[model samples]
Target chain A: MKNLWFHLMPYKDLPDDFREEHPSVWVDIDSGLLDAERVHQHYHEYLDELEFAGEVGFDGVCCNEHHQNGYGLMPSPNLIAATLTRRTSAPAICVMGNSLALYNPPTRVAEEFAMLDCMSGGRLIAGFPVGTPMDTIFAYGQNPSKLRDRYYEAHDIVMRAWQEPETFAFNGRYNQLRYVNVWPRPVQKPHPPVWIPGGGSVETWRWCAEMDYVYSYLSYFGYKAGAATMQGFWDEMDRLGKDRNPYRAGFLQFVAVGETEKEALELYREPAEYFYGRCLHVNPKWASPAGYQSEATIRAKVQSQVALAAAQSRAGNGQNGGGRPGPMGAARDWEQILDLGYVIAGDPDQVAERIRQVCIDLNVGHLMLLCQFGNMSTELAKYNTRLYAERVLPQIQDLFDDRWEDSWWPQPLEQPATARALA
Target chain B: MRETTISVGGHPVRVLTGGDNPSAPPAVFFAGIGGVPTWVPFLDRLAESRRVIVPSLPGFPGAADFRHLDTLLDWVVHCVETVEALDEAPVDLIGSSAGGALAAEVAAIAGSLVNRLVLIAPFGSHDTEDPGADIWAQVPGPDSIPNLVCERPEAWKHAWQVPEGAEAIDYQVMHTRAMEAAARYLFPFGDTGVVSRLHRVDHPTLLLRGSEDRVLPTSSNERFCAALAGPVRTGELEGAGHLPELDTPDDLAREINAFLADQELG
Candidate 1:
């Protein structure tokens, strides 16, 4: 339960008042604002926090891959992970990795991840996500219909490559392997722990539940949008009769804390706006292509948008939503975002309590917090990171310790010969 | 861990690197023409402690094939950028055979990014006195080795084979096509022109050659050392062919270990 993961990003730097006037995502700004020097400095700052996070007792720090987007600013998370291994000790190196299907053969992922695991002394947690349709279909030129199958096949090949002791043969629809073996197998026995990050899709949730892998809901659309999806996941676990284990689930949230709520809000306003407005400005072609998303998921997105509109209408009254922040109160106005307590922006005490309340409300076992969002300065991000590490993390360290008794929920399993066999 | 893949100029390239060691600078090893990463032995040795990366060229064994890559400079820039992205910045480069050509171009263009370079039997140009590259196919024999310094002509007689052009390897057909591609783009020998630019390279460089290399003469390696602007060092592995890492791994490893020992991991 003390495993607090931080998503540190180099936000597009802007003036303090940028957010007050513009209610958009921080990444929407032009690329001219960022230079190699700024990028270099920002990288060191984030690394400092990762080291600080471990020193403060968090089990790991998290970095992810995104390309041609401003929201996260990390086109190559492995680069960040490589640097992290030298900068920090004690924390596991977690990369919510390169999209499997987007890669050819996928054994490259196996090889690199194995290398990271070895270099880190077996403290590597590998993540596989059925990549976003936009990046998959448009950017990588994968077919939407075949995306799922390719992703699954890539995952299968990677796993086999990892577990196989010697060369074996594998011939699949997408990949053919006459000899299947990767040098430098992961240091962890039968490979390190595998976590599947999800975007609240039915297929992902069901698959994670069935496979008994950790389901990290990278909460971007907020808690409300995720409510039904998580319910479906838990319900599947119930039907499968798998005893509930908190380790099997995790969630991500954007967090910002200051000495006072006013100061925090003032600091967060501009960058938060940039994150929502500029960075996330998705071309409809990329974000929601025709036939890209399933009908059910598309409907959910539309419904979420409607809810956002209604909330914004209510917030226009200029009064908080009956003590709860209205759509505009704390929503940050992300596109179609259902602000269900995913974000915490306030003073240390207030934000800490908010985080605790959200964790309890969501029953989320793992909390991967994003301390740096949008174009927040490196110094400010470090301040938030230190404050959380020193002040807030201690408050909720025991929220889920000994919370589950399901010893069989998802214990490490010896690799079966079939799965380990060459492709 | 799964293999990491990225695209360069619409070509899918796979990169496999050693562990996360920020203090340790990254090193890139290029695949042989028509070759993938799994072909070499030194790949493992290079990845031992340093951050090492290798990319699959698009038209290799199983990748989407490109007709020919005319300019070695473009390929070099692509490789440098790919390596930079992997290490979050610049890195050292290692190349063998034709890959050595690409490595030299990368060092010339993105000179600042390369901390050091180790080129093995690099193929670009020889002096006017040396026989020009045969457009047909290359024949493999003792003489195919690039850095043979044996004074006894009879000793190298058995090692040298009759001149044969592109028909030497299974990838000869692809090399023929690549030659056509180069013909289309007028393959630039600018890397040779920029030999003096090697002095501009702030990082130290070590050139490794086989003692009995026939493809590239020992003089070429010596000229490479003299032309390099950076601190330059040269070494020859005895009883080695062009591919010494494959024929004599221990001697090659010892030479590399000796060179790397002098530099900081940073």
Candidate 2:
């Protein structure tokens, strides 16, 4: 299994009544509640934890872009990935990734991603995401109706800019550029490995399957809530007659680890409550901006609804138990979070056992672990990262070793002539 | 009244036509985001003197679902093609709310097609500062409590035919379709740069408003009156709201006749 560490970088301190007072943590969030010094501290701690993940031998370190959001501080995840290029020799410097629709020229993505590739010695996994409505349509004022169309065009432009040697004119309906040329083409020949992070959108699953890119179910909701979404993706792969290679998918989940379940609960309660209560307290109004979701996606939500209904039924039964209050939709106590599987918090052995079962059941190979979440201290995050790497990672590291080949992983790096000669 | 589908650029656009006499100039009615059905009564009243044509702009229910009309330009082109189909030399154009903005732009784009223009709380222009009360925010969603489209809820309750007790998918689909149509012309607040080219409008225009309407503020409607190039007339219905034609058809008909009669120099 490919273990990756993910970071959300939420502001450490939010008010007790943040849920009641602030209808949303995105779009039109009150700036009065934010302290510059606190965010400055958050950045330092988040970077430290990511670097520690690399040091502790995670297969990849991931970051993603979010705009006008208090929950996620990294609007330019590429900037963070660039910083990680120097800090660690990790296998993949995953900038999971740039919101292509938001960029004006889009060739800018090609240029920066290529730069990161060269700097990391060919260790770059490019993530293409159709941003959330709050980030794309509301905050940026992108015409919701035309956002996906623009996204596809931008993706085409960026890909061509990276691989195509000759300059060409891009006459997209939204973007019209006279000439497109990008310096420092990526080191991975054609381009870096592409991973598409989806949020239960049918179009995304189909697009990912057709493109042969990895479909990542990156929901704040725990694996238990997201199993249906993952199953739908696997089902699509089956319908398309594609191989059910476990590497074809990735899943992100919140997790905490300690010597025992009691200690884990004590360590993670505040952060878990903060995340459920504050980070996910987005206003429903900002969530859907007219045409932000395609008509087909809106219709396909019925299928998701069925899947969700099944999950809820399972939750009601003792079969799929986790947080009592659920991971997403509202704030919950640590016990509720634990009951709902929003976080696999326990001793190293317990975490490994739960994580192993989650992986086997969902048929996922790339496990993106959220070790640093909602106000987790840098020191505690480092400790958890180390524990997961040393104890939990060994228990199930060999489960998918012989199952399927990961076409999505970044290719191994080439050593310099001097280093080879010395060896 | 006869409802039929007309072919424009190989796409079938549904239109409702009533009281036709080829010799007399037709009154082309541009229906709002709700489509052309509710305007049946108002169109019947307008049809008393002369012919009337009401075409559903693409993307709304009862109209072509395909996204052939991709941009606002495509919509203007469709309206132009629609006018050409009528072969009417000088037709009076009347638009309501979202449709009002469409009619105003149609007149601006194809000036010769329109002889005189009347707008009922049209959505195209806005003041950057206050930017009128947001209509999208006010529109009822699948989960939201049904809000009145006009000031007097009972007067036009039937006019805003909001879906009820639909399955999750159907509810979402209905809400999404309406929101999508609104986003096409009025996404960031109905301003489509009509303010800059209002001088291009060769026809006299009437900017009508409902005084008590909160959606499109009266202050912003005043800007619309000032932006026009030709002789402009303005009026407000005291008790009515945004959907004035639906709420007070008699008063709206009186205002329409008086304006058209004066413009005809009769």
Candidate 3:
């Protein structure tokens, strides 16, 4: 398994009464709640922590884009990735990525990704995400119904701009460019490997399969809730007559490993609670705008809810994620999170065991370890990264590498230790 | 009323027409939130004297997805093509809620086809200050309309009468389908650049608001009134909410008739 350290530079100083005072953590997160000075402090701290991941032997260091969100402070992952490129010599500088649809002429993505690749010496894994409805639809004001269309068009333009030999004029419904040429062409042949991070959209599954690109499930709920989506993706790959190469898939899991299980449980409880409870308190409306989700997905969601409701009634679970929030949403405690497998919390042995199970079961070659989550102190995050790198990485790093060659990973990921030494 | 399909830019559009007389001026009614069913006795009442064309804008009920429309301006082109196909004089247009936003766009660009435009709680743009509550964000299941759409609980019976053995999930699919169109045109805030182009709407227009419409409070419409250059009048439907035609159809019809009559004779 290719273990990569993921950073979601979240605001750490939300008041204790945030759930009661603020209605949401995304889109409409109250500006009054943010302390600019503290954010400045957190930025430097988070960057230092991200830099530490490389020193601690993480195969890669990743950053992602989010807008108007308290949890994800990087609206422009490219900028952060650029900063990391200079400070760190991690095997891969994964920018998991710029929301492709948001940029007017998506050639911007091509140009930037090329710059990052060149700067990082061909060590950039490009992540093209349709983005969360809150980020793309609500925050940036893209039409949800047309978001995917824009995303596909943007993806096409970015690819052509990177790979095409000559300058080309592209005419698309959403984008029209008189001159389509990208300068500072990527260091990698053709372009850096593209990793599409999807949030359980079947359309994404089909697109990724057709393109033969990596279809990464950037799930918050870990393997338990994410199993269906992962299975669905592999099932899609099967339908498309594609091989079940684990390298074609990736999964993001929050992990908290310490010297002992009790140490992990005690150390991570507050941050985990802060992350899951306060960071995910998004308004239902903001989370899912009309047309953001496909019609089939909508129907499937409703049917699943109905099925879940029936199952709940049969078992008297009385859990509704919406409205009453009986046993779901931001109100969930750390124990609940552990029970649901949202986080893998234990000693290195236990953490390695659970993550290995995730790799084997989900058939994911890339395991994105979310070591730095909501409000984790820079000290704690660095320690978590170091612990995982030292104790757990040896256990699971070879899970699928012997069987499958991961084309989606940066070239350095092939010989990360050598790459690090040379750098 | 007769339901028919008309080609708008090669995409077959679902349309319902009634009172189609050769000489009578056309009065096209655009369904507010969902589709043709949302507008009840008001649509029938308008069709009594003139041709009332209610096309299920793509992704609403019988219509296909609105993805073909491309941009918000494409919707205006679709509306223009729709009006040109009417084969009648400038029609009086009535649009409610989400439909009102589209109708407003049509009136701003294709004012030649409109004698009078009536917008009922239209949402076409976003405003940072008074970002109205999103109806889709709330829980109603696909099978039923939210109570906020109606001022009185009993008012819902006039429109959303659930059929026997009807699946709530089906309605949920329809609800999402309708929302896809609306969110495409007007997301977060309902403000399209119509405010800048309001001068193009040379016809008399009436902006009607529901007294209890929390979804789109009337206070947020100040910019719209200021932007409108023609005899842009504002009125309130006494006890209605966002979807007046669903409940106060008679009252809505009376207001529409009063406005159209005065605009016609004057």
Candidate 4:
């Protein structure tokens, strides 16, 4: 129903042999590979593309946090979100959010999010993510065992800091604050609608359901691979006797549209290959650190499709022959990528049909479309965004809106003539 | 071998006790990163002369949770309390790898409870120049066992192998939990700032390391030797890895026993 534009802002110029030459795309990725001039140019171009998404017609624009990662350039997505707030008017600035555990005194996040909300005139969708093992545990050096504990405590502190009018003393296992009073309160009463971007953690689903927050599954693998995780989330909601309002869930998908299916596929092939092959060239060792995943989630993962594929790969090789390359590791041609539904590439009608089917199948209400991905030039990104905005978005925008109210969406105040004049 | 539970800090810790001589002061053995889930042969050899008490540090096999211990200081206090709760004051203390660092801390803080201290490849002091291999960075399961816990990973498979009747995934979870517990204290940099406090320990101490330890550098042993205020002796075992207890248990046990007896180690 709500088509939001998402950007990974990946470094587009990684050499063709990056996968072979580089140990990983994150954490310890060699600093020599990055070009300062190119990165500066890329940042300006990416920001322009995000603003263009707003001007052309996206309901929201999204950015997320990742540290020491080549694929995700934004270590501090708040800075990007802050810029977007001043530049874009109509679109919600969705910062799919800060890794809570990394902040020393997490009230820093509380203060920054409040500032963004005020800057955006209340058009802010606050995202709280229990960041990736690469970001939180490896890059930030958070104790994996205590990461979740620290995140939960930080969440409580941030929420209390935002909602509590009076100054308070907070004591937690991970953090102890003497006087907790956040300045410059957010324009949204009680706080902006909270969205939790998670990577198939079972505890995250249960927590989202219990807290009545939107569970946004930000999967790089497309909807076909993401269906199970989304389904798992809905099932948990069902078990908890919560309504399947659909607005409670969000799904991210890589989409590129053109005049014809063949045209779209040909247009996106280079970027798709670059994104999947090089951007996702993470070392298997860094994939899952100890205690980064909960035991229950690990159990679920063992029975998942990815695990089955790994088992088959191991069987094909000798018993002691090293681990199976992850889902993103194997070399995939364009057809395999399309067949596996890693990206939805087609004409407007075809793209709309596939997206609608995916939303209905997964019961997803917020469709976070990653129109700009790895190595896509500014011209190509705008072309993809404009084409989708002109044709595909209209067909899918009203699918769930009439049936359900999106409580998770931000309710921004109507802009005054004076504010527009100042801009 | 006898199995019992001792309540330390109100949490029941699983302890393994064995040896021929009960009249002598008990020898408390704190396990390394590869926790003692079952009876290890190295403990058996050490138990031959004196009573050996091996407590499954929290989040390891018998002790199932380390969440209650908030900080490294809390872990140290818990270790000291476990040692004190044994009703054997001034006992000979031996720790291996991660446990070695912990044992050194206990000896530094509670000198009265530890008569003699033995640290096998201890991890309390860190030298930035010779910072060892990143153990936490290694992939979990069979692939990393050689780099982390043992020299002969094939032979020491039992250290992390899935038990009969237990699901493979559960074994993975257990192994990960143990590693997580270890990471809680020694993450990022394996230093706990114990090097500065080592001057407090006045007891006779012995430091041992495996010649082939890939997880810790030889500089760590030197760091401990330089910082320790007590009478210190250092030895290295040939053909042993980070966890010499599982690599060359006979040689490791002989070294520990000799150290506790105040005799020259062969």
Candidate 5:
């Protein structure tokens, strides 16, 4: 099992009545609410927590791209990943990653990712996300109809830029590059391992399986809410006649570990509420742009749990009348958040047990554990990371390693000269 | 009304033709975002005198995928080809909302194919100070119907009603497809550089706006008028919204006919 530490690096100081006052946490988020000095402090604090997770024992540290939003502050996640390469040694620098469609000439992503890979001595997981509708279609002004087309074209360009030994002229519908060649080729032969972080788009599952890439479902809602999506992925794999090599999939879960279940709840309740309440207060308007979802996805979603919950809400029965809370809807209380599996908080043993069950149930080998969430202080983040590293990780890390080889993981130089010189 | 499938730029386009007089130059009607699934009462009124031909712009309901017309240039070329395929050179072109923008573009680039142009609540020019409501931002459903597209939501609801025996989900998908196609040109803001190209449009033009239009700003009317290098006539329809044809179809049809016949405004 591969346990990676992920950080959303959310703006920790949103007002108490942020959800009430603000219409959305993204796209048109009130610029006045953001404090530059605090954001500066947050960068250092969040970077420290990520590095601490690496120092403790996480196999990788992950970050991702979001734009014009308060939810995830890193618009340029590669910049964050670049810093991680210099500061952290043991962990894989996972830029869970650049939104390929947003780059004018997507070769820029290939160039920067290559730089990060070389800097980290090939410890880089190249994440190619189609990006959120809010990020891609709304914030960046990408045409929803053309976003996926541009993304696929960008992906091809990036891959060819890295692997095609000779400089080539590329002509695609969205992009036309006269000369396609990345200056600093990644240290990893044939490029670094590709992981696609998706929001359970049915097409993504088929694409991931066909490409032999890791399909990482980065759900804000934990394993319980994520079960259906992961199951759909494995089912897709089965349909494609591919083997269920657990390493082929990844799942992200928010975990808060402590000495006891009571202590854990007490320690995490505030941050958990903050994350679920304020951070996820996205306006329903910006949630799903037209053309963002393919016809297949839209058809599939008509019967999806979230859509069913939405229908119930529209029928005036209320969303939380029964069953789990919908992923997009706010879960304000700690009890509802826990009940919905938005966050998994308990004693180390209990947390590990739940994680083990999750892995076995979902068949996920790469576990991206979000130890630090909304408004979690740096000290608390470190404590949670260290506690999980000390107890929970040990019990859960060996679950799938014995049976499956993680082909999707990065292959860094065994003993780097830089490391030897530092030692 | 007679319906026929015509190949325009190698894409099958569903065209609706109707009128009493076929000898008069055809008044080619281009529809707004919510396409002409069937002939609305407004088109019926326009067909009373001269021939009316309405072709579903690609990616809208009754049309092929919008992907075929990727850029604004592609759309303009497709429109030109569509007009040419009708075998009516120098036709009277009438467009509503999004289609209005397309009509203006078509008239600008291919003036020889257009005798006169009518743009009703067009979306080509954008005013920063009074930029129209962001149509793409509105959530697709009943709640957003009024704010984004119409003044009278209840009346306009029938415009997008799910056809008899059609599944509601399928209707929703169709609606999404149409909106996606419109957003290709109008996303973020509705400005598509047609304002600059309006200079090439030397044909007689008529611009109409809904007095209560919530989508296109009032300032946009002036922008469209100022940029057109032609004799321009402008009118406002009361008790109407962005889609005047749906709001006050009779009034809209009268205005269109008067402008097309070169009658003085009352």
Candidate 6:
């Protein structure tokens, strides 16, 4: 379907003027209102937004986990997924999930995600991301060098728990549990579709293609910046003799829709600025040396229009004489981010056409849109949501509807008895 | 000293005391359900400085739960009376695990009496979902060995095993037998909400967590810090687990001393 998956980050109580001054990437709203009452308010509003996204004819909705940070107040995305199950009747509840290695037994994820699938009537799209260095190494206390290996181990454990029929013993480098029996088997036969969200790592692209999982580029960078990575992914797919089956590929873009391009740009400019400035702020220490990518791949991302790093640095230096440090300049520059096309603000028809072009260019099956970002107001987001669903969504509705009918992972899961009977 | 082995509402409780100078502040150490007088070494470090008392809890350690007391609330009331019976001018309380739940209840019930409090991985508040099955049992394989070791290897071995003198009532051994019988009484999930009553506790509080502790984890300590009514300070001793005093006595003693010194200064 050409329809976009729209997500709303309901942070309405943020300072009204935050988006005005901060870059769309970095609206550092003060956390003074982070008491229990405000937290509760955000929780309900966030749940409402998830339900609204599903109602708007989005193919799927997304939620992710972040901790001790105001950028995304979703410390527990699974809780949101649970709420989504009861609220929205359709749409996949995506939990760009529990960083595998951070959890003691990766089966905690296996069990919870399976439970989410059952609750959603098999509408779960499990996302296994080898989380960012900051999240993996600093926040979760995982060693940086061994991050991929731990993630692989976690992936294996969760997959085995879903697919293995019997109670088995899994002894891995990280997890060593004696009995492995996850209850409430997933509704999806073998498992729900697996989506690997990558930030342009060659290793990830090749692995996703090899495993036949949908490779979703979480493009916070813009379309032009993401071109190389997208091309690299398609190249990997080609090497595997894979067909351009849209379901195998997905791309996300930050989109804000309004009556006209000028209005859209005006409405989204500050929020977009905040997104580029405060929210994209990364500690230089955490940016880490570029790992697991060819020099050619790195250079390609640098040359792209989406080179956010340069724009960020220029903004960081107070390009508008704001002198406020744009948050993204703490690390790499415009060259690294230029190709990572993250921001896409325009009117409904313009966005719809642009998205269609993006799909055609990248040969991507899914288009994930972030209409609400960097403290964008709920009213503006809802407008974008309505416009996308009413105008843009219909334009590409039939683009891939009949192209792929079979699921990549459709094997039935083994329904094994839990070790402990509920007393 | 009004020393007594009292039978109250069916449970037989033994209380011992020291320091009765009316001007001296009162301190109570609620011992773990390990049955042995393991708190003696730790208490000796505090007794000379404050009016101190330690009570042996009923059940599992072979003492009878006189009224067949099966809940955390019942145990808590029994503890409050035990302190009141001494007639000391209120008491600052310290409790470990199940005892911590009792201490929290005492602070809730007799808020005026509690001057300062310390609770170490108390087991009694049953708010969180019952960790019904032992997580260790659910573990898939033998991979979590690093979680057990602290900086000192001998300390871990010592902490797990019961000492020769009172080997039968070792904390780990008592945990096995008493856990099944005590879990229902231990995980009184309903009791968790009352910790908010800590707001009534008008005294400074200190929370201690072991950095490498996998059993209770650091999240619990964070929750404890959030709930307590008064100002709270939390310290994590690296390379220590559930029994920090047993594993890293120096670090635990240093924290206790520092907290006490700060309290005295305040």
Best by the DockQ measure:
5
Docking class of 3: medium
**TM-score of each candidate structure, all chains considered together:** 0.53, 0.91, 0.90, 0.95, 0.96, 0.53
Task: Please give, for residues A398-417, the per-residue lDDT of candidate 4 as tens digits.
Answer: 89877898888898888612
**How well is each residue in B174-202 modelled by candidate 3, as lDDT tens digits?**
76787677766666466667778877776
Q: Highest lDDT, which number?
A: 5
RMSD of 2: 3.7
Q: Please state the error at residue A36 of candidate 4 in Å.
A: 1.5
The model with the greater DockQ, 1 or 3, is: 3
* Predicted complex 4: DockQ: 0.72
Give Cα distance to truth, residue B202, candidate 6, Å: 51
Q: What DockQ number belongs to candidate 6?
A: 0.01
- What is the Cα-based TM-score of model 4? 0.95
| Candidate 6 deviant stretches above 4 angstroms | A2-36, A289-341, A406-423, B1-266
lDDT of each: 0.61, 0.78, 0.80, 0.86, 0.87, 0.62
- Please identify which of the two predictions, 3 or 4, would achieve the higher TM-score against the true structure: 4
Better candidate by DockQ, 3 or 4: 4
Which lDDT tens digits does candidate 2 get at residues A1-423? 899999988887878899888867887888898999988888888998898898788999999998878889998999899888877775488888888999988889988999999888888999998888778887888878788888999999999998788989999877898899898888887789999888877778888988889989887778887787788788888889988888989999888999888898899888888888888877776766677778787677656556656887867763433322222354377776777678889999999999999999999999999998887788889988999999999998887888677888887467612223223
Q: Which pairs of residues collide in model 4?
A: none
If both were scored by TM-score, which would come out higher, candidate 5 or candidate 6? 5
Question: CA lDDT of A147 in candidate 5?
Answer: 92
| By DockQ: ranked, best first | 5, 4, 3, 2, 6, 1
Query: Model 3: residues >4 Å from true position, as ranges?
Result: A310-331, A412-423, B18-26, B47-51, B102-112, B115-117, B122-145, B153-158, B161-167, B195-207, B217-234, B258-264
State the weakest 10-residue window (summed lDDT) of model 6 chain A: A318-327
